[model samples]
Target: MTVDTAVIATRLSETFVAEVTGLTISPEITSEFGRSIYEHYLDHKVLVFRRQDIDAGAFAGFGTIFGRPEEHHVVKLRHPEQPTLTYLSNQDELGRNKEMKTSGQGWHSDYSYKLVPGGATMLHGLEIPVAGGDTLFADAEAAFAALPEARKEFLRTLRVRHQYRWSPDRTDPWARWQYIGPEERKRTPEITHPLVRRHPDTGRESLFIQPRVIGSVIGIAEMAEAESTELIEELVAHITSAPYVYRHSWNPLDVVVWDNRCVLHSATTKDLDEKHVRRLLRLTTHGQPVTPSMPKVGYSRLSSR
Candidate 1:
């Protein structure tokens, strides 16, 4: 529970978000400091470390402290040299497909549809837009805490099914925001995960329903479609409300680490807006991979030769 006074950890707001300063990151960071970072991460679901000078190698190294880095399902955005790194931006990367623009705009926990979702997802800003490209994160842990006792009991009995290539959910206003093309849709069978699950280390229950990914929501005992739709809308509204949210305005070289298990994050226009170019390096750790795990070394992951 102790951190070096030289390094300061300050709460970003009343929410479960914090900012840490006075520490430097490298591929080979001291185990003690990395451990401290992990402890703080568990305490605070979101952490901001500004002015980092880390590269792809160091970013992957930092990620492995919690778990082996998980390659994002949308493989096209991955870095050429680092399999664990995802480059998010409106600008293009060398040798990358021109059509692969910034994606993942909707609110979601990274790899939420997987049986086991990721823990920490780190995003380091390389270039930030002049204005209006901020990331919004909602604290699921807090949201769960604020729910009604009876509703919490009911939520525990629900299951959500996610289909990769399924049709858009008419109930979700932003259903078409993240397009899943035909080839990518059939890569995995439908997955059913708990509507409410506990954070691995913290043991606190948080809602896990991401309607953008979850094609259907039903009670384990079989609920009607209209009931399920109403439940999904009710939950989404409750979780994303302002009291549970923290808006992160980016700075160049800022590294943000958020617990995917307890946070629902949405990328602002900077990640996709054509009018402005925004770029960042993201590393996600510890999740069940549908595809083969990307090797941590040697040749990079390339979708096309």
Candidate 2:
């Protein structure tokens, strides 16, 4: 299919998806362009644009049209001399595989580990594997709204802990917290947050627990663990249910922007040995921290490995 470069927004109503065509914004365009993009992001949750010809510098300049760009916390920052982009390939600078696990494989909001989680994320696909590398996004707001009244009420008063530790069975002990340096880990250890998060700008609640990092629901009794687990799983199921979800098959030059506050996304894996490499540049928006005054909910953070 031919992907056009003109700025066009098309909605995929089947899954509440919106695609914006011809995403390459000229460096000469006024800063208002970025603001317009942000407005669309808030309303649509997902924006897809095509920009095959623009280079990294041009992409960075385009990002500035939305808001101040921040250094990616996990991914290595792009070079100072060329501030326009960062490489997102599996291969390292030496052209060797970094063996970096793709973080987007599971459903998650971008950078929820941080005190200020990412608000939005823009990913430009530089290269794409032929098949099975599409990214899927689920609308958390829609998920929350569809919850049963009892479920919503219960979650509103509960809190969950978020940390960097991986699942005990899946993670190597030595590799525990390996994603973050000691200093960074200390600065931002497991923090408590409401299980249901309210968007400061939109005043809408979203299911905010990070199932991977969250240890347990605070104040829940030990005997109730089975019940708690079942309930949490149900909530996740609701969030990822059909009609509210959309999967985007990647194409070279496709740039997707999504609101981290309201969407949960995952990437499908492709063959590692394939000659073609998949690369993308991601830019994330920052989120405000949840305060104690917001709610009296109990939660527990897993021990630091």
Candidate 3:
């Protein structure tokens, strides 16, 4: 598709998504233009911008329109020139992907374990695979809306625990990949957030659970251990059903952005090996603190190895 003088947005799915075209993001982008894009983002939880061939810096700049771009916790994955942007590639320095595999295989909302979670996440597809490497998103807002009134009430009164590294005894592939040093672990402590999160901008409640990746409902005083575990498993199954899910296949130069507040996403490249390489440039925006004590840290210098 060719760039146009005006941007165009078309509904991708009624479940909730929009495709944006004809806009080129640059240093010259005006505030009005950025605000318009954000309006579309607030309306649709996911926005697919077609043919965005911008570099990492420009991609990071585009991410700022939604919120302040934040550096990834993984220091090695940070782009050299644009530190705010990170690489999600199945390749090493020598371009040999034989031993490399994709990350974020489990469904999760980015930075859900942090004191201040990520507001939104944008990915620019650079290298795409032939068959796999697709991304799946679940509509948390829709899933929460579909729940029974009694269940919703119960969920609203609950608080769930989230930690980047929850358990130390687990021996899984993700555990190896998600390993953090003592300092990094200290930076991301186990925090409790409302089971049902109300979006700051839209003021809509959504199921805020990270069943696979980060944490579980462990802090609710009223719920027992087995009961909380059962409740989390049941809700995860319900929230990820067909009606609330959207699978997105990648295309070269495509920019896909999703609201981290109300969406759960997972990478579908687990079965893929180095032979089928997939690479993406990712930038995440700063999110507001869900609790009173968790202050927003826009940009912080954390030495990580």
- In the order shown, the candidates' Cα RMSDs to the true structure are 8.5, 7.6, 7.1
For candidate 1, lDDT tens digit of each residue in 183-212? 565665567777777665555667886554
- True lDDT of residue 27, candidate 2: 75
Can you give the lDDT of residue 83 in candidate 3? 84
lDDT of 3: 0.75
Clashing pairs in 1: none
Candidate 2 residue spans exceeding 4 A from truth: 1-8, 13-15, 73-77, 80-84, 94-99, 170-185, 213-225, 270-274, 290-305
Worst 10 residues of 2 by lDDT: 296-305
Best by TM-score: 3
Q: Choose 2 or 3, whichever is better by lDDT.
A: 3
Tens digit of lDDT per residue, candidate 3, span 1-305?
12233556777765677788777667666354787777678767899987877777788888888898898655776888888888788767523243335546777888787778889999999998888889989888889888889988878888888777565345754563245577876776778888888777666678888664334223444577678777878888898888888888988988999999888888887787767878888899999876321223332321120
TM-score of each: 0.82, 0.79, 0.85
